[model samples]
Target: MVADAMELATRALLEANLGLAEQVITGDERIDDARSACEEQAYALLALQAPVATDLRTVLAAIHAAESLERMGDLALHVAKAARRRHPAPVLPEPVNRYFAEMGRVAVQLARRAEEVIRSQDVAAARAIEDADDEMDDLHRHLFTLIMNKEWEHGVASAVDVTLLGRFYERYADHAVSVAKRVVFVVTGRMPGTVSDDDL
Candidate 1:
């Protein structure tokens, strides 16, 4: 289930990066379906296996992780939609595009790492996922600064579109980090990091 969710997330990110809004939306529906199936299966495991303690944590974490991946897919679709709406504007500045691409790359990498940690029950690998998430957060902050400064300034509409694109990408990274944190809790029996209370 984690593998399937991760694959969908990877596809969604790739589609958004390529400006395939319609395809991203279509893919999101499938991801939503997979999320629902995973949720039901996790609950079924709980009822049938009578899991307890750490076992229970693993099942619960799987469900949460699936939901987080679904949210990441949704955010990717949002970015694709924003891209579609901003059509005919000049392409984003090279630097901004480069940053966005790098952000997406990090997101995909983290998603893959999270899946590996879950599959292998490797707590050490989970720590690496957390560290990778920190890098993503830093990248997001840098992109936000660039967008706010109107470094490219295609125009008012284009600027708004780019700003929203950056936000969507950032939110996508955040959800991936959230999934990694859940993996940490499932493996270690405790949440590993500080999270802001403020809404993004």
Candidate 2:
């Protein structure tokens, strides 16, 4: 769902297609529905199954991951709306379009890795997702540099659009990384960097 939304939102920006933007906005409803269903089922299991320890962690992690994924979808929808708001005026100017395009591709990659880590609980893949998120963060910083530089020609409106676009991608990557971390926690009975007094 995040992948599809990212693709549509990217296309809307690149093509300046209001229709695609609207499609992305409307498509988010289904993603929301899917997330709600997942959460509902997780809660139902918690209520009825009386799961403990590993099972409890699994359910909690699932709920957390689903929530993160839904937020990622919302960020994609925001990107689409930005494109729609600036319709006929390019949201992303030509020079900076490649950076956003690359961000979209990396978002899709991280989202896919997030799903893989969720299903397989592979710690190595979860770490890889975190590394991919670093790339997204670097791209986001580069975007800020471009817009903040005095040579920027697109002016305030374009600057606002670019700023929002970079944030959407950055936040989407954040949620993906969160999902990956939740997967690690579910598998290992611990978060990546935290420790209890006993471990200390």
Candidate 3:
């Protein structure tokens, strides 16, 4: 659902498709609900069972991952609102639109990867998401440079939109990284940076 929101937000921005933007805006509540359900279920499981070792880790990871995913959904919602606010005028202009589209694609990819890691608990795949986040960071820096460039003609408003939009995408990727790291913790019995898998 978070991935879908990111994709729709991108499509809405790139195509100036008002309907898609509306869908993203309206559908955010469903994401919130789903996130709530995940947290509630995880809590219920913890309350009912004295889970040991891997089981305890799995439940805890679910709670953390659900929170991260909810944050991702909120970031996507921000982008959709930005698109809707600037409808018909185009929130992104020309070449900058291409950069945002790339950002969008990477964000959606991260969200999907986070989902997969949560389900499969693949530590290798979780590490891959950490690497993927670097691309998002680079793209975010490029957005800042784009606005600072003297040749920029989109004016202050579009520049502001671009900055906020870039941040939204970058933060979405950050949350995905958090989710992946939680999966790593579940599998390795330690967070990614605290201890190496070989040491554990």
Query: Ten consecutive residues with minimal summed lDDT in candidate 2?
Result: 191-200
lDDT score, residue 18, model 3?
Answer: 87
Candidate 3 — worst ten consecutive residues by lDDT sum?
Answer: 191-200
Q: Model 1: runs farther than 4 Å from truth? A: 1-19, 88-91, 150-152, 191-200
Tens-place lDDT digits, model 1, residues 1-200? 32333334334333433434556656678878989999999999998999987899889988988888787777766765554554443335546666666776776677677667767877778667667867767877787677677455655665676666666656666666667677778878996565322134
How far residue 131's Cα lies from its native spot in candidate 2, in Å, is: 0.8
Name the regions of candidate 3 deviating beyond 4 angstroms.
193-200
- Model 1 residue 98 CA deviation (Å) reads 1.1
Q: Write the per-residue lDDT of candidate 2 for residues 23-104, one digit (tens) a residue.
A: 9999999999999999999999999998998899999988988888898899989999988988988888899999998999
Q: In model 2, what is the error at residue 112, expressed in angstroms?
A: 0.9
- In model 1, the clashing pairs are none
Per-residue CA lDDT of candidate 3, range 1-200, in tens? 99999999999999888899999999999989998999999989999987989999999888888888888889888988988998876789788988988999999999999889888889999999989988988888887888999999988988888888888888888889888988888899985663212110
lDDT of each: 0.66, 0.86, 0.87
Error of 1 at 62 (Å): 1.3
Candidate 1 Cα lDDT to native: 0.66
* Model 2 per-residue lDDT at 80: 92
